[model samples]
Structure formats: structure tokens, C-alpha cells
Target: MFTPVTIETCITFHGHVCGGISLGYVLANYAMDKLGAQRGDDLYARMECQNCLVDGVQCVTGCTTGKRNLEIIPGGPMALTLVRRDTGKGVRAVISVDMPHGLSKEEAKNHILSLDPAAICTFEEATLELPN
Candidate 1:
């Protein structure tokens, strides 16, 4: 029997990259509420750029006012990962719900169509571990 695998979508926001962590938190909260995820539950994951440089030089960065790895204001990068609890059904539900929030259905369909055909896979099939 073929077991259904959980599907997760990773959204990458490219820009100045600064304040990405804060933005990621805000977006995650919005997504969780929009997706009806429980509070204190791990609905999504965020990754912040630690050390990045601009113009071949290191500078302070980030949304919070303080010294950071880089000096660029928007040099930070943010990544949001949405994971489905159930394998098949949850994936479909999440996609159906979040597609409209970020990108329109038509745009999402087109984007998916533009992707490499072989890139489709399951999130549960891969083991992801966060650093302590």
C-alpha cells in the first residue's frame, strides 16, 4: 500500500532581507490565523540570514535596532515553511487556503507549471532538524 506523505510549502521572500525575521513572524502569525492553526503550535518555520555582506563589505542589519551580521538594511533574507499535519488531505487544504492569501490561484497555477516537473515531492519523506 502506498502511504500518503505530508506536503510542505516553502515561501522565500527576496528583498533587502533585513527585518526578515520580524516579517516572517508576522507572516507566520497571519498564516496561522488564516489557516486556523492552533496557538503555540508549530504551524510554520522561519529562517533568518545570520551573516551577510553587501558591496563586498560587512555591516549591521535587521529590523531590530542593533548590530547584526551585515550592515545592509534589507540584506537579510527570510524563509517561511508551511507544513501539513496530515499527508494528503492536509497538503491539499493548506495549498487551497494559502494560495489565495499570497498569490492568486491563477498565478500559483502558472508558477507551479513553470517549475521543474521532477521537483515535486513530499515533506514527510524528508527529515528536517532545527539547530539547537
Candidate 2:
């Protein structure tokens, strides 16, 4: 049996806390709650982005490359789709916050390290079709 995952563990597993990590945490929880799906068993998360967000999803949702449930489509913006196998329900979300702008590299770094990661991003949610 798989132990339930926590946000704290996800933060640790993803190496550093950031907007992407929080996005993953929220996305996974949202799917589990809305779709009545467990993270480890029937829920598969497919994300488009080759970045930190994928790591966060992998860590928190028990979905990863090894499980054949996580797919990373590179060269795309940050977005995710959570699909529940048993019910064929899914949720699609895209980050509502625009990418950071006008900040120096140092400022960007500081912003990433100091700001509330969860506050930096919000998702636009909608129903979606789950892949067969």
C-alpha cells in the first residue's frame, strides 16, 4: 500500500519550493478531491512542460515516468491534465499568472526564494477528455 503524500514532502522532494511546486500540489489535490481518485492508483497526471513543475507532480502525486502515468511533453507552456482511469474524468488547468517580467536575474531569484510560491500562480480550470 502507498502512504499518502503531503505538500511538505513534495517540497522536499522537488528540491526547492517555487510556484511550479505549489501548482503541482494544488493540481494533484484538486483532481483527487474533484474526481474521487487516489493519486497512486487510478489517477494519471499528464503534464506539458519540461521543467520543475513536472518534478513537483512526480513527487506529490505518485505519478512519474516509471509508473507509465506521467508524460512530459517538452517545449510547451506549463499546463497539466489529471485523468482518473476508472471514471474517465479529467481536469485541465493552466497557470493564470503571467510569467515574471522586468526583474533582474537577482530580483527574479529573490522573488522565487522569498515570495509565497502559491500566491504567484492560480489555475484556470475546465473539464477535459481523458485519453484512452
Candidate 3:
């Protein structure tokens, strides 16, 4: 079985697990599965915000800023577009639910992790023009 990277891995990279990391972990896996992508594939990630979620995306997709494959554009929303460089095709996952308020950090993380990708995000097909 191809085990998807666990949330614990993202938590280790992110220094802590929170709602954003949980959401990112779930959505990144969903996007990769939908696109038939594996970690370290020739993929590009365009992120819409800078937050803990970025770390989760980085951890799961292996598309890091240092590798110049992940770009943060600061669009003021929690969203990500993961594109396959070879095909210019991708999936965009936009946050559709607000992070639950008044919950402990661990509680929030667990709650977000439990949600289906469709429950926390709305996904759309995307086409990207990536550099060679």
C-alpha cells in the first residue's frame, strides 16, 4: 500500500499541529491523489497565504520555497494550487470552512484532520504555465 505521508510528519516539520496544518495535510494529499502525483514529482505549488499550512504543504509535496517550486502570493485566503510541471494541470483547493474557534490546539487539529477534504475545502481544476 502506498501510505500517504502522515499528519505527524507535517507536525514535525511545522513544529506543532494546528488547524491550518491539518487542513493543508488533508488537502495536499487529496490534490496529489487526484493528480496522480508522488512526493518529489515535478510539481509546483502556488499558495495563497503564508501560514502554518505552508509547512504542511511543503512536507507532503516536497515543493518547498528553497526548491523554488512553491510560491506564496499572499492572496489573503487559505488556498493552494498544485500543478504538474509535465502536464500543466492541477487542482486548486480553497478553504471553505473557518477554523473552529475556542478549541484547544490539539482539539482543533484533531477536528480538522477528521474532516473530509470536501468538508473543509472546495476543489477545482486548474491549469498552470510553469517555467521550464
- Whose TM-score is greatest here? 3
Stretches off by above 4 angstroms in model 1 are: 1-18, 42-77, 87-132
lDDT by candidate, in order shown: 0.27, 0.64, 0.84
Report the alpha-carbon TM-score of model 3 versus the true structure: 0.91
- Candidate 2, backbone clash total: 0
Global Cα lDDT for candidate 1: 0.27
Comparison by TM-score, 2 against 3, better one: 3
Question: What order do you get sorting by lDDT, best first?
Answer: 3, 2, 1
Which pairs clash (backbone N, Cα, C closer than 3 Å) in model 3? none
Model 1: how far residue 32 lies from native, Å: 1.0
Q: Please write out the lDDT profile of model 1 over residues 24-92, one tens digit for every residue.
A: 333333333334444333322322333211211111112121322211224334322333333211111
Q: Is candidate 1 or candidate 3 better by TM-score?
A: 3
**TM-score of each model, in listed order:** 0.26, 0.67, 0.91
Give the backbone clash total of model 3.
Answer: 0
Candidate 2 Cα misplacement greater than 4 A, ranges: 1-3, 99-132
